[model samples]
Target: MNADIKLRVSNIDKSFPGVKALNQVNFAVRKGTVHVLCGENGAGKSTLMKVINGIYRPDAGEILIDEKPVDIKNPIQARSLGISMIFQELNYIPEMTIEESLCVGNWPRDRYGRINWKEIRKRTKELLAKENLNYNPETKLKELTVSDIQMLEILKAISYNSDIIIMDEPTSAITNKEVEVLFQKINEIKSRGACIIYISHKMDEIFRIADEITVFRDGCVVDSRPIGEYDLETVISQMVGRKLENNFPKEEIKLGGEILKVQSLTQKDKFEDVSFHVREGEIIGFAGLMGAGRTEVMRSLFGLDPYESGEIFIKNQKTVIKNVKSSIDKKMVMLSEDRRRFGIIPVRSIKENVALASLRKFIYSGRLHEEEENKAVKEFCEKMNVKAPDFETKIESLSGGNQQKVILAKWMVTDPDILIVDEPTRGIDVGAKYEIYKLMTELAKQKKALVMVSSELPELIGMCDRIYIMSKGKVTGMLTRDEFTQESIMAYATGTKIQKEVK
Candidate 1:
């Protein structure tokens, strides 16, 4: 064991019923450095992290802390050993106050052993202040946005003062400014001789924050080297085991008649007077900052939320979509940005989740036709390139990318004319992202109107025929492909410049 090594795992092997999650894996992290793990989804990155965090027990492995072997039976034990993890999924209880959520395991106590609410609030306020979060400590988690919850999770993990911290896609939902703050915090942690084991699919984030890079594939270690020794191309090739010629496989498709149109969509305190349209075979993007009302607009369009004053026209017919069913009936479907919350039925099997929305298609005489439903699920799963042991497998067992693929398959079963995808490639690896882009291209080729909401500027530029930018609940600018640029998008997104409309 090296003196500088903070944590090490030897010959780690883990398995599920039909999956070999980790195989003879050997990994180590040194003090005062960011060690990044890069791999495709279901390639054992999260599995290995779970093992370290004691959320999962390895069938065969030895974990060492400071050169001494130890058995970590659970998360509490791991935390006690100065090991903390910020999970990819936000796990805070929505009903709990920020102060209570932050002090879950280590609550401050008075002389009589009662919880000291004053001390808890004081501590939470200080922590929030240190992170530059302006939220009230008494605010409930349910009131916060996904990005806000993500930032709080980071703060909670850091508050543990751990020697080894595991961050899995910490920047997946946060804004660029918050990402900068997170990077600064990472540097401060490094200065204090702490080790960081980071897992992210984002190439830029990897190159920017990593001191060393380790690539995983099929539950095995492929390569580990210092950041200086690898470039973007090399790291990506190592991750997917092949060279990717193009990150965005956008295709040209002939535009057809306008299929969906929104006029004067307004939701109080959310978004106001937002107007956008997508023609058949056209992919229109919504680009903006985190709270710029992009997601809110999509939610409203999909009937997941209400818009006070909006006229929705489908194929030139005024359609009233007051709920999700109405939206679906109008040949429209949405893939939400928060997949776990709005997209997936986690406890259900992949087949069930896929067939959920389109169950009517499989029902014959008030009974589900199993054979027909199975056939459709199988076809779409294959079309989406979903990697799973079986359709009967629980959807939660699949990786984030595979889960997303299943969700896409779910909506595709409906054969909708309009598809609204929010952050479609979020938290997925580069290879998966490429596949999704290809799928989107294919969908456009099929003359299905696609409305994409994404924070990544390059993604919108590459895939969208035109983009609508929003800032502070207003449509700031609309740009065609030729005008798409990060500088221009940011100018619109930040309210530095605005255009009422662009055609």
Candidate 2:
């Protein structure tokens, strides 16, 4: 109950159908300190954050603000009590402009009792400038990229002037440079005596910014201690309820002939003269910084984007893939990086989503085979270890990792020979990431070609047989396993060393 304690939750309990999300959880944060929460997906970290922010009222618990017991019934109430949050999933009005979204609930008023448009623009410009973002105040929210939106949300939380700030995976979609800027801002906020409850699955960030560490496992608090008291191994062991044997369980598969080849692929301003190839039973990686055209090239390859001049060969045969259907017909599949936007249908059941592309296989006698479709969906979901109440549940109800698993199920149902996964583990926990890596390895062993695009260089170095570094719209460097290094990749990604020939 000391004043130095900025926020506290005692005996917090929350539950949903078929899941006890939180069980008598206890957490506290001191003023000016960064308190980090680490846990596997569905281990009650996100649920706890929701409870603290009043999105979900604890079934039995007490919340204290500066040692004073208070009931927070809604997010508005939590904000009024000097609480602000940056959610992992964006919750902004896409139809609105950046200025409008930032000014939500706290718009400056004019003397004539009207919304102050000019003041809103000024504040938005100031916030953008503070973060070194080059976004127009009048730009629609939907027009901004994922990283830009994340930076804007961080700026919004900082502008709240709150005593307690909850950041849920704030750096998940940002670049390393952006993360450094965010850490600097966090230090500045700490100097002003604010409490930051930081939640993330990334160990490096946790160790860098956390003053106190709390680990959650299976809805219970595993341990809490000073950051110095916990090593990386101890933290990982506590998070998954067991020691993580290997972060990347990559399998060495027998090499085969090229399964996919692209020559002189040009997507106008997005990417130009892009060239790459993936061989059977091999895992190829595309490594680059943001805006380096990795995703753009993948989109073109998957037929989600149009290219002006390019030649694509599938299994030594020239093909014209002008749309997703053609790409699928050619036995190629893609898992989009932005799952919410292009991967899953939120309102649809898992069965429908999983069987979406391969529904033809379930049709017989001019009728839809409902039972067969359900059976196929179940098979793929189980193979991916998708943890959900049932296939009947809506896709949106699952956690990010589980949703990602379902997407994998959805694509694998197509029985594609070539798989392209973009940012496969962007927002997933370490435990789930290991599972995904295992799945990718299994696919490789099965002779399915894979092209994985990731911004994390360590992931490339860990799981890839070879890496192709992209910069500005070109493939700058290609490295074999022995040639892989973070420094070498960055050198090519930043155009410092582009002497390596394109493969």
TM-scores for every predicted model: 0.97, 0.96
Instruction: Spell out the clash pairs found in candidate 1.
Output: none
For model 1, residues 1-503, the per-residue Cα lDDT tens digits are 59989999999999998999999999889999999999998899888999999999999989999989989999999999999999887666779998998999888999999999999989998998887778899899889889888888898999899999999889988988889989999999999999999999989989999999999999999999999999999999999999986657887788999998899889999998888888999999999989999999889888888889988899999998899999998889999988877888889999999999999888879798999999999998997778888999999888777888899899999899999999988877888787788888988999999999998888899899999999999999999888888999999999999995644
lDDT of 1 at 358: 96
Q: What's the C-alpha lDDT at position 37 in model 1? A: 97
Q: C-alpha displacement of 219 in model 2, angstroms?
A: 1.4
The Cα error of candidate 2 at residue 300, in Å, is: 1.6
lDDT of every model, 2 decimals:
0.90, 0.88
How far in Å is the alpha carbon of 40 misplaced in model 2?
Answer: 0.6
